[model samples]
Target: MLQSLQSVAFAEISLAGDLISANRGFYVLLQLAPDSVVDHVGPYINNPSFTELAAGAQRAMPGQVVYQGLITFLGELGEPRSLLARVCRQGDHLAMIAEHDVRENENLLAAVMDLNEELAEQQRALARANRQLAAEKAEQQRLLQELATAQAHLVQSAQLVSLGQLAAGVAHEINNPISFVRANVATLGGYVGDLLAIIDAYAAGEALLAQDPSLLARIHRLRERCDLDFVRGDAVAVVAESAAGIARVARIVSDLKNFARINESEWQVADLHACLESTLNVASHELRGSAEVVRQYGPLPALHCCPGQLNQVFMNLLLNAIQSLEGAGNGPGRIFLRTGRQDDQGWIEIEDNGRGIGPERLPRIFEPFYTTRAIGAGTGLGLSSAWGIINAHGGRIEVRTEVGKGSTFRIWLPLSRTTSE
Candidate 1:
């Protein structure tokens, strides 16, 4: 409401006679510029000095009239003008209202018109400043987003480096023992077969020595005590099972090495099916009791991509599917992996029968540090990193999800590397 009365010549002055603030009308009456610095009221008053006004205000109570009379004001051109003034005590300050005489009304009106034009120009300047500030703010936001993306990439690189080192170490440490044990199991199996043949030969000789019934009875008792028949059959089965177990361990280590791809950092034309298999094998422990995987693999050609990075993507998606199933209630959890080639692109789809994403959260699922999982359960960068890697490979990812049912993520990559890549 006070801002609406711009034409009123009102001023607030301190007890020490310093000019506090004034409206456009006051500046116009004094013939001063709109943004002029009027430090003291003493220099502007020609009739009564500000000292006399302060003394008068000190004698009156707050909200009481201090001085009511004509005051002579000195304009910028040193022209003295007399105007009717009323001063009131307002708390620690003095409020003054001044009005020009009837004969000087025309001059006051002209000055007011000039003040309005100056005010309009100032407003325009303020508006331009606001626009510039807004643009600068938007630029800052863009830079921050770029910084976040760069940080996420750095984190993913570090993780991959660590994984590669670990995989290399495990493969080296486990492969030697696996090879020795495998060979030992094969030799032991042959030794057991020869021992069983000797036992059978001894049994036949016992029949030949039937002339000594006591010797035959003693041999029968010894065989029964040792459970020779059961041992003969179980021994070969145990050795075979041990060899198979050793082979499975070797396969797992190989799969881990393949999934890590420590030595294959550069782009290559590789089998996508092999990559998927390696990833599945690497995450076998996590999927064992949680979710059953179903594969619907189609004929796909070798795709030009970073095998390690694609493996990382597959790992992330597979782990998320497994976790989702774990969180789903006591129903059977299933994950479907599908791959196919369409035109020049090959697509891999991972779908889960677990709790799905809601509408509000679907859009930001790939945003870094945005997660629906409980704190410490996830880093929230899995999907974001996957998205970044696919984009870097000149590929794209699509998501299809429904609440309470499940979610499907399909990654589409070009069969051949593009020139831009």
Candidate 2:
């Protein structure tokens, strides 16, 4: 067994610490000649406890002793190599030594540590990228919210401007009826004075009639001269007319109030014709001089919408139609306001027989700040804001026109409740 073990390429040493022989494998591992290895055996070994190992090996049974140590070859400055060695004593002549290489295991440990650090670096980079992307997304959302808020304010401003334009016409409409009511009241005041005088004359003369028969004739002459009967008949007519005038003024004011009250933003179910009527009345002053309005009101259902916003939209389109008729000389322009429902949709059409939109300008008319009207005469926000409102209400506006002939603006709204701003 000992000879076969040596043949398997283990090194051997004598009891005197001299290398007896070594196999080709040992010389190949150290890249040394067997003669050179034998010559330097004692000096080449780095272990200081080899003497103890040797003593232990001498007493130990064959193939029963093991030594774990590092070996440094002579004249080599490289790190010592780790080895697992086994010692076998044979017949008091020699001990056999065998070694296994463990240097690659150390190199593997260093490579693994480097790979762990590299992986940690990549993880940090990915985490930073994720943070940057999150910040950018948050900023984008904030800007979008600001933009939406600005658009809402712009639409509200346009509505207020449209109402300001109607103020003059509303005042005029109210003033006309008030003027007549005041005049009738003044006439009635004069009639009251004359009738009171006649009453005083009759009441005083009744006592005098017993004393003098001429007193009754004087009372009759006073009534005839004052024309009390005619005054009494006319006063009834004047009072009735004055009441009608007051009612007319009240109606105009009520309509104006209804139109103005549409500023609420919440959606509600409302009559489409009522909204149209209010809008028309508000724009009546603009229409009076520029065009004559003809209502072609059709059957329409109550629709769910923001009534105030819809009123704003209706006023905008109606005002635009009236303004388009500005130069229709010789006769008043005609504006046809129509409403109807078909299927699940309700529509309003404002058509005018006046100057129509040019084909080039028509496409851009709904663009913000785009207008064909003279500067200071229009803010150019009316139609654009109207478009935004209708869109937000789940509705749309359509237009048809021929240059110099006429133009029509039609708005179609869904009957169901719609989400809006």
TM-score of each: 0.68, 0.53
**Judged by TM-score, which candidate is best?**
1
Root-mean-square deviation per candidate:
11.7, 22.5
lDDT of 2 by residue, 286-376 (tens): 7776677888999888888877778888888888777778785526689898999888888999999778888788888887666777888
**Highest lDDT: which candidate?**
1
Residue 128's lDDT in candidate 1: 100
- Given candidate 2, what's the lDDT at residue 2? 21
Q: In candidate 2, which residue ranges exceed 4 Å CA deviation? A: 1-230, 329-331
lDDT per model vs. reference: 0.83, 0.69
Backbone clash total, candidate 2: 1
